[model samples]
Target: MGGKVLVFGGLRGSAEPRPVPLGDLVVLDPATLEVERVVSGGGGPALSHHGSVPLHDRWLLVVGGWDGRRRLSALHAYDLAGAGGWARLEEEEGGGSRAPHAGLSGHTCTKVSDREGGVRTQRRFASLDTLHVDAAARRYWRNPPNPGRSDEPKGNGRGLIERLSSLIASGSASPRTPRALRHHSMTLVGPFAVLDGGECFNKASDTVCNDLFIYDTRTAGGRWYQLSGTDSEMKRVGHRVLVVGENLCLIGGRGPDGTSCSPEIYTLEINT
Candidate 1:
């Protein structure tokens, strides 16, 4: 319920209780509300009320949901190019199972260009890396952290002689392990991917955040800053967000009370 909702295939009726979550794929045209059945592979377990997003070209990436009884961490990609069928990607090795990952249902998953050319460039594909956004942890662990930073040296200026000795003898280096984060929302701002608005659950309920983060492939050092200037809303959970050009459109979602489908829309402008 706290994931993304993809408008593909076509809009169908409200999901009804059925055996093995309905495998039917319905996408809302946004123009017309007509329900159309996009080709779903053979008789696989019916998938309904799950998170889906457009991947590369004509491919949809689906992850996590209740399959009636148990929650799923299975990562399946549906290729919409030919006669679309489901292909399961290998699960993350040490990463524990993920469920109800935010920004999945009713949320938006965008394909961002890692390079300046576009998404189709080979350079972009070479930089194609998976970012695991742990909503509960409030951090992002890039599969391969920035190589340049990961191999940098660290430590305060100590004895100059000792520092020089250590640098030469041991090749002074500081490796930063990938981190896990929670409560953050990940979206694409033009060619850059932005991770914003989440709290680090360290301090006792006092560390809620409204900070904005930007990761650009061209830049060696990423950028992070608090969203100032305007009277912005508090960081919220269960809110659905979609990227339309340089603007991010946030829609109805659960507040402090509970889950809501009210017709409220908020737009955030980004320079991209």
Candidate 2:
């Protein structure tokens, strides 16, 4: 993630009516923009509209997405170091489960820490299912059955739930959790998970929001504080947001009407 760039399954844009699904995992040189290597997505299926995040800056964790016709339940990881390739990480909770990710697309995955009230964790909500975790599991891809030193936590790829439990155990999480949301923007700012607008997970009303919510990862239960104001009323979806200094820079994204809004960068002033 820091040195090289990774590309996973997507569609072939040149396809007629719609892009055809692809399953190749491509690694590229960040500077030269040249292809480093391409390989089959290990035993994973071709996917698009999925959520991906870097784990330890060495592996790419890929979770739920459309496998062409239907929503996929598999989770995959691409190793960026050594001779690692793609590896499908799964768990046998309750004997069998597919939607362990709760729909990963449009969700946000964050790396946080609640250790000794210091920090070190990851979590997911909605479509985001944090994967690609742990530096010790670098060799996991080479052999799935025999992960050797890969512990049960990292091996099962449950970084999200595991870290969330740890955070709650730290007695810093809020007692309540936010409702399921998709296409929302959630970023970390000083141990706090700040969330912005996204459509309701229900999709029945397709309600896009323009409010702000903050979760103090240092507290129990997933409690959040919602910020309301007159100026923070621009309904957003498919947008991107990041913390810049003391402000939040909202980037290009379509609005509720499903049309691209004006070419403007919105800023939200945040005090701590």
Candidate 3:
């Protein structure tokens, strides 16, 4: 969140769709673009295509990504100001922790506020909770809904979404959790977390969307608005939406063709 440039393990010069994931944490000099320090084991659970956000100013919250084999629901935290390395957040299970909800990959986790709450419904239990990252204690708790649930074909209790969408970026037939985006981009603007251009998880969930979908962070319970009837001719993914004054600008990103990266920039007008 500060002026620090933090990087986790990611794919580099690989042709395979699901290449071996990396788990190293590195900090870079913001001015010189040079490596400052590298923590070998700070990057928890070899991950790629994950979502992350800064906590306070010395911690990073990484959630839900592909771990070389399958999608992971684990949320790992790293302490930048200390030397404790990585920590896995979970519930009490034989003195170990576990995932709290169905796993997600290529999804985005937006930071609304330090304190927020939401309601969740599971196969058995309906829980009311929120995300809690304790920077002072250097620990993360699964105050989120649906404790100890998994759907990655890892044989968890009553797993959901048995088949992976054909649109998954990995180009595999692996089973994944519901709403697992392939490689979308999401950004926070004003009061909404605007989601744009991502691979569709399944036919039942959503189709390949290039249009704008806004989620009101004011309430994490239930409120998703889609701006349909946009220019369907241009399909974008892995793109970014920037708020330029009263207008939102769409920046450069590879088109749906997966080859040509558009050089033009366009602004979007939302009727909100």
Q: Write the per-residue lDDT of candidate 2 for residues 28-94, one digit (tens) a residue.
A: 6634657888887466668765655566656677656777677664556777678877777654334
- Which model, 1 or 2, shows the larger lDDT? 2
Q: After superposition, how far is residue 115 of candidate 3 from its true place, in Å?
A: 4.4
Worst 10 residues of 2 by lDDT: 140-149
lDDT by residue (96-202, candidate 3, tens digit) is 23544666665566554544311121111212334555554544444444322111112221111111111122333222222444566665554444567766656
User: Which stretches of candidate 2 lie above 4 Å from their native place?
Assistant: 1-46, 82-85, 90-105, 112-180, 201-206, 229-234, 239-253, 259-272
Model 1 earns a TM-score of 0.47
What are the runs in model 1 whose C-alpha is more than 4 Å off? 1-26, 29-53, 65-71, 90-183, 198-200, 203-212, 228-235, 256-265, 270-272
- Give Cα distance to truth, residue 169, candidate 2, Å: 24
lDDT accuracy of residue 208 in candidate 2: 77
| lDDT assessment of candidate 1 | 0.39
Model 2 local distance difference test score: 0.54
